[model samples]
Target: MRAYMQGGGFVVEVDPDEIEAFSSRWPCSNLTVTSGKEFLFSAENGDILDAATVSRGRRFSTEADDGSALAALADDACRFGAQALSLTDVLAIRFPDLAQAAPRP
Candidate 1:
């Protein structure tokens, strides 16, 4: 995962290869959901700030991708500030069910 501040806003990009590699090893079901749970707990405890406005990006290709993941990251960035986040965080935010299914260590 790549995260940085750009154009006065935060940006996070998860590499497709990373996703594949991680899934091959831990799998979402094998990896524990500690990070996701911790993040949510922190957010509930007032660690996260208010959400920011997210704008839809114009589709550059005819692919069926809806960019919901991108929007989820934007919302988190706005709420959590520019602190570093991980692939698990992204997955947790975008695919809560998968994260919740993560195996306990």
Candidate 2:
């Protein structure tokens, strides 16, 4: 299963079972897993940690305006045999020259 975080700059791939397990561990704030199809994670202040969509063998897509926080959550999700890749990393690989052209500070 592949979960894509909209505007979060990363995606996590994990089995559907792992996604269910993760959702079970975290409570949803606004949505319910009626069909075991959606999951939402929010902070105490109401900021979203992650949001995901679950399917036959895939689950959850988390999104947040804060890229750093989203990345951290994605990292945590990886503990369940999930693999994550950042969009920045993909861009660097796809456009090496551009990636290396940035001025060093």
Candidate 3:
């Protein structure tokens, strides 16, 4: 995953094909009554990546591709909410194309 920040906005970019693989590893919500669960992503570098799940309840226990948020991404969310967050080397991403620019691991 690639992360960055710009204009005080958090940004995270992952490969489109990586979504399914990532989601399977990190399940977001299991609520079925039109409820919503939030994801918080924070990294050792103080980078936060946050993405909210689709506003409706899920029919199954599976999470959506876009439902998962990186620990590194949550830092921004925490900060955006005016809450306390801790991490180092923070990076707020505004451009998603960095996903492509990111080095392959």
Candidate 4:
């Protein structure tokens, strides 16, 4: 998807088909349900941490808006495995980017 700055904030575009392919029986947020898609967040200036510097501020980032929070969710799914997670947990944590991109539900 194209990435760029708009009005001093970062923007990320997502493909709807990819979104559905990624999640199936796992429940989605009201936002995702209504929009029928998932979102990813980005920053206008840049990522909070350069991957090379991913260690220093790896904790839950305050900048982790809705879109970015999905990264955390993906992390959870990876770290714990799909069967281990519930729809609520995935829907609860707001990826910064997703939050912004998620159409108000």
Candidate 5:
């Protein structure tokens, strides 16, 4: 599994099992999985700001693939009261084990 976000221009790939475990443990209400290819993270108003798309192997993409769509969405969401969270903060919250193991500057 992979999580991609343009906010930090990062793509984090982990085992599928780990992703499943995290999903089950946290169960984010704003996350939507569709057809096993797309994962959308929406704002409180249901506007998708971040997204991930699984391709072949451990590779994945994000809403940033469509030019500045991800940025536009993020901006719109923020305008409508969505608080911005950095990719690091998001990863730290969603994958505490991995985040803790990573080197920090």
Candidate 6:
């Protein structure tokens, strides 16, 4: 998985076949994207709260509109395996440039 900024919003690109490694069951969001697809979320404001792609499936995200908040959410996803990893975790290694921008805990 990889994430980057595009047109003021965040775009998450997920590979459809790789989701099984992260979760046994499909995500709750039920959002689907093409294999190696990119989903867009506006930075300014939008109705969508959370969104993710998993093997052509989907999941949730935070409702905050702040760009930094969104970046932090992505960071949390990247660190899914940190301590006690859960099935709901996104299980990404890290974001590209956004990883550097996200504040460390």
lDDT by candidate, in order shown:
0.34, 0.38, 0.36, 0.31, 0.38, 0.37
For 1-105, candidate 3 gives per-residue lDDT tens digits of 344443454344333334445445556722222333243344433234445433434322224323324442333343332212222223233223333343333
Off by over 4 Å in 5: 1-8, 27-50, 58-105
- Name the candidate, 2 or 4, with the larger lDDT value: 2
Candidate number of the best TM-score: 6
Per residue, candidate 4 scores C-alpha lDDT tens digits across 1-105 of: 333434433333333343344445335521132122222222321232211111233322323224543453334322222112222222334334333333333
The lDDT leader among the candidates is 2
**Candidate 4 overall lDDT versus native:** 0.31
Those runs of model 3 whose alpha carbons end farther than 4 Å from true positions after fitting are: 26-105
RMSD of each: 12.8, 11.2, 11.1, 16.2, 11.5, 11.5
List pairs with backbone clashes in candidate 1: none
Error of 1 at 54 (Å): 20
Model 5 accuracy (lDDT, Cα) = 0.38
* lDDT by residue for model 5 (4-84), tens: 443423333334444344346444422223312333443223334344545454335653344343344333333222122
Off by over 4 Å in 1: 21-63, 67-82, 85-105
Please write out the lDDT profile of model 6 over residues 36-96, one tens digit for every residue.
Answer: 3334544343213245433335444323222443344334433422212221212222333
**In candidate 2, what residue range of length 10 has the lowest lDDT sum?**
39-48
Which residue pairs clash within candidate 5?
none
Task: Write down the worst ten-residue block by lDDT for model 1.
Answer: 32-41
Model 1 agreement with the true structure over 1-105: per-residue lDDT tens digits: 445444423444433343344345433333211121111213222223222221242213212222444334334433333235323443466445545654433
lDDT of 3: 0.36
lDDT for each residue of candidate 2 in 1-105, tens digit (9 for 90 to 100): 454554433344444454456556555423233323332222111123445654565664543222443333344543211122323333344434444543333
TM-score per candidate: 0.28, 0.26, 0.29, 0.28, 0.26, 0.34
**CA shift of 89, model 5, Å:** 11
Model 4: lowest-lDDT 10 consecutive positions:
45-54
Candidate 6: worst 10 consecutive residues by lDDT?
82-91
